[model samples]
Target: MNVTLRTPRFILRQPQVGDAEPIARFLNDFAVSGNLARVPFPYHLSDAKAWLRTRVPGLPVENSNFAIELPGEGLAGHVGFHPGPQGPVLGYWLGQPFWNRGIMTEAVIASLDWFFSASQAPAVYSGVFHFNAASLAIQTKLGFTQTGRSTLLCLARGAEVEHIDTIMTRSVWKARPK
Candidate 1:
């Protein structure tokens, strides 16, 4: 869908055809791509275009994806959900230049707030590569608890990596301190 979520620092909107340049530029860095399970390293402009082509509007909220935009920076990151075997899986990434700014935490909070309001799903699933402490911290901060561990293929790394599975149940989310 054409949903636009706003945080105090940035806007989360549907990925656009025009975002290809920035998307490619940011994700091309191995530092950024390496942490993601699905993105390839040396990510190209064409790769960005191909990925953007799949971001069709009018999908259900459970399948929502967003392009995180900063006022002057164009696109700084992305945050979204995709269907997984267990449930709706949340995923996100931020450009290296924007790291340590807490931008992602804000974006995720907004996304989840909207998600829980829009869907009747029982929970949201997410996980981080074992080395991604920052991403895991974000999840725990938002009330997601560890469920177990598994291995996931890292497209950029070209290998399977240990993944820490986490979930946020609807009741847990509703009870979370705002």
Candidate 2:
């Protein structure tokens, strides 16, 4: 897979040693961490370092993550996937400062394009908290259909929240309007 993916206003690149600071900064926020299932509140520098240490730019999407960087801005967020029992699940987050900028939407599309072309998985899946309308809209607009519903324990929220599971099979992706 390519280490660096570019859209008009963003560059999704592999994380380097210097990225820990910015990543820790953005992820440390309650608003950001609250939406993520695994990320804890009060994110620490070590957490960012540990996360970046796991990024393998040249590895498969099932084992990599990217630092979402803007030209003048540093790290805007993260977008990547991890291997799971069900399939390859797509995950992403952006700094609160960068919200409402259509950045995540662009990032998701680019990530999906690369994901579908490179992996053997039959589909890509995403689970969004029911309260997060933005993410729900993003997934729907990108052609993901709800597969089911369940509850997930959110680290930041410290509770089991209603989660909507969605998937975009290879067939659905191909037949969608582009």
Candidate 3:
């Protein structure tokens, strides 16, 4: 089932149609969308609506997705896992206003805590475009280690970009700081 995770300052819950407005607004900025592999730049309300349609509820936590909400700010962004060639991949993005405030870091820790506790997967895979040093730093703080590099299509940039692959094994996550 789609799980709802709560942190001291944020709520991680399922995405809904109402979240489309903020999703489009935040992702429309190239600074935000360009770092993401799947989102297109100039992201529109219709695009968010279409993507939200795919977030089927009642799916297991492994396949579930979350809309990151600040207490009074509505949808701040998203963090969730989806199927990848190797295993479940962690993916997330935040509105520019919410950047650098440790919002994503808190949400990610909560999500990973729940994910590792609920599932038996050996590891979770994630990566950032090579230029996204900020994102890479967050990954590093969470004990995710670089696995390799590969070129991946960045829809917003409309070209291939270098991606630094990383993985967090169960043991590392189990030993993470609380």
Q: Which whole-number lDDT from 0 to 100 does residue 166 have in model 3?
A: 98
- lDDT preference between candidates 1 and 2, better one: 1
Alpha-carbon local distance difference test for all models: 0.92, 0.86, 0.92
Residue range 1-178, candidate 1, lDDT tens digits? 6788888888999999999998999999998888989999889999999999898867898888999999987899999999999899999999999999999999999999899999999999999999999999999888899999999999999999999999999899888898
Residue 49 in candidate 1 has what lDDT? 99
Ranking, lDDT, top scorer first? 1, 3, 2
Worst 10 residues of 2 by lDDT: 52-61
- Residue pairs of candidate 2 with colliding backbone atoms: none
What's model 1's TM-score?
A: 0.97
Ranking by TM-score: 1, 3, 2
Q: For candidate 1, give the lDDT.
A: 0.92
- Which of the two candidates, 2 or 3, achieves a greater TM-score against the reference? 3
Off by over 4 Å in 3: none
Residue 50, model 2, lDDT: 91
